[model samples]
Target: MKKQNIVIGVAPTKRSFLSMEEAKRQKEKFMAVIRGIHPDVVTLVDIDDICENGILFETEKITQVVEKFRRAKIDALFTPHCDFGEEQCAAGVAAAMKVPTLVWGARDERPNTDESRGRDTQCGMFACTKVMRRFGVQYSYIWNCETESEDFRNGFDSFIRVVSVIKAVKNLRIAKFGARPEPFMSVTANEGDLATKLGVTVVPISPNTVAARMDQLIGENSPRLQDYVADVKQRMDASGMKEEAVERAAAAKLAIQDLMEEKHCAAGAMECWSAVTVLGAPVCMALGELSDEGLPVSCETDVNGAVTMAMLQAVTLGKEACFLADLTIRHPQNDNAELLWHCGPFPYSLKDSSSVARLVQGQERFELKKGPITVCRFDDVDGKYYLFGGEGKGVDGPETNGTYVWFETNNWKMWEEKLMFGPYIHHVGGIYGNYKKVLREAARYLGMIFDDADEQGVYSL
Candidate 1:
């Protein structure tokens, strides 16, 4: 499936009693400041055509504004107060849309010596927020700052990422290939709760179907299989791998992609205990390539792990690939460092520049490049789902084996306690960015408890 895009309805608001010239000027400047955002990232649909001065002020124009935004298929509504805004009108539009809503006001100009202000954007924002509450419209807020200010830019980026995260989970579709191994009880989750509570759909893949597809490509020597093997050779050091094994891994990747497309799945969870029978190879490299290509697949049939990957990918706007890793062991030397490793399933694109990308025995091997990263786990107790999010940097450490990294969290002991006491497992979905705030807001909208490992101390089960 193609990555989703966010459409924001930019509806500037003002009060009739406010200085019209000043409000108009503020609206113009606000547009100029934010227009730098690319259309691909967030398509801006302004209300300039629906009302005079491109400013919203009159309650009578609410219907037209909402209709226009609906036509544009806006994923969120942004109502900026040009001056003390038309609170009632803005609230009406937000309540009608019923999507994620946000409101902000430019910092008001300094008041005159006699207490006369050029415009009271913040004062208006306060009034508008009260009306918004009365209307029962939930929304996000940006602190009162100039639209061009760095603080506002950070808030705006965060808001868009939050919207993307919500989009990722709403009606999410995950593919299930084979059953979870008996030993992997930690990855088990309730499909009934996922469907009934979260609106996520689980599509099961028949083992026979997977076997037939892989056999067709390898046994028949399909030309498509050769193309994929060539891609494998170009991307990594496949010379040490068996020729037939490399071909089998390539076949598995193509077969999985075909099935995901036909099944309309955004991600996948596949059994790995009997890798030889299920995928004809180790299957680690196959999973890695799929994630690099934008479809993350979790090993050991960890469906929630796949969900976690999709969530992290959404926050990055699909610009970075996600890795599902084992939260294996603490550093032998560094007090705060821990090893994040998997047999061979990390995306080659995430390899450190200093490390060599290699494929041997159908597994990937390389150290992931160091950077700011976020690791999160999705799980539940009973029917109450939650997202455990924590941020850290990939640090230097001894590398023993597999695709791996040494992560130095803010507090390793604290993080360990949270997992030990919570409904979490060793498998975590991670990506190369600090997205804890984005994940927190997303969990808020999803109605899931967000366990912030950095902020919250260990709690009793």
Candidate 2:
């Protein structure tokens, strides 16, 4: 995983009621905290000259700082108030940088009769925020005035998460194979709108092209195919599966891999059902393998689902894989739980080891790993994109063939209502963790409507 690059700026001013020595001390402390949080910090402007105002208040100085940040390709900016910060300078840097910005300050010292007593950074932060608003700059901030407090660390972490999502979305390119299956209009996406509004590009490839590639690989007796087959046999109970089915699935996986490499795509969505007619096996297991290997692939040509999966991958830095599943049926024993099942597209690593193993064709029958999971979807209504998600736990459930998980949310009825009445589909992406907060922050930064289903109720951002 690539580390997110961050640039730290300390805003100090001569007009601050505090002495130069106090400002320099606070600046060093802020730099220490920033250094502990991230490694790739860019000190765009020198803070050593405390005798002069350290803040870049002049337009020329702010422009020079912006140029430095742009050249370094920083992902986000952190502005800390050394003293009463230069509001104009902070806002100027934020507006010009055009990246996720965070503003914060140290707590004020108790006033004394001495001239060097007051820092008044809390007041400066407020003024800086107002100027940022006037300049139409969006930013995040630590509400607490203390720079070394736990609250500040948490807020800083959240800001990093937000930056990861923004960077991923801005640079994403989805490989779309074939089209949405017949009778599944819910998965249809406006590619033009996706590109124009969200900076997401879709590279279309035909199912026939993939099939042709698979046949060529088989004819050439590719070593990759042999390795993939060996891998499948090693990882799965393939005694029940047909030999031809196994070969076809492995060939399809290779073909998809080839196309992904050729197109330089980050994520993919495939026509799984249609490919079954051509490849002699469902592509679910192939997709699962790809997702497990760090590239998320969605079934039924779910473009938005692939995008959502990509977002999850970016936020988690591939530490977890997102499972693409349909909200199939309600759990028989648990009224508040629903069954999330797919043909066999869940990663093998997520399958329960104790479940009766059956690898028939490209489909594997097993229960998903039991733990906390988050269910989410990215969709649009009237050209406006939205992200919806909530937390749930993966619990023990009855097996009904294929990859399955019993997810119990706080309120199934409310979830159903949201899906039914909202611009969402039955297809959703699930990742193991409580990442609703991360997703919500990403949605806010991306300017997308976020519908969060929590215990209290559904709320929008």
Q: Top model by TM-score, which number? A: 1
- Pairs that collide in candidate 1 are 84-124
Write one digit per residue (lDDT tens) for candidate 2, span 1-461.
Answer: 23333344444443344466776677777666665664442234443443254554345566666666676666777777776667877788788877777887777767545654576777778888899989888888777457678887767766666777787788888999988889899899988998998899999998888889988988888898988888888888888777767888888888988898799887899999876787666788888888877778899999999998888776664556778899899999999999999988888777776775567767877788888898889999897888888999998777788889999998888888777777899888988877888888889888898887663344333
Candidate number with greatest lDDT: 1
Q: Score every model by TM-score.
A: 0.96, 0.89
Give the per-residue Cα lDDT of candidate 2 at 426: 87
Steric collisions counted per model = 1, 0
Error of 1 at 346 (Å): 0.8
lDDT tens readout by residue for model 1, 67-138: 999999999999988887888898999999988898898897687467565677788888888888898887
Model 2 clashing residue pairs (backbone) = none
| Candidate models: Cα lDDT each | 0.86, 0.78
Model 2 residue-pair collision total: 0
Give residue 102's error in model 1 in angstroms. 1.3
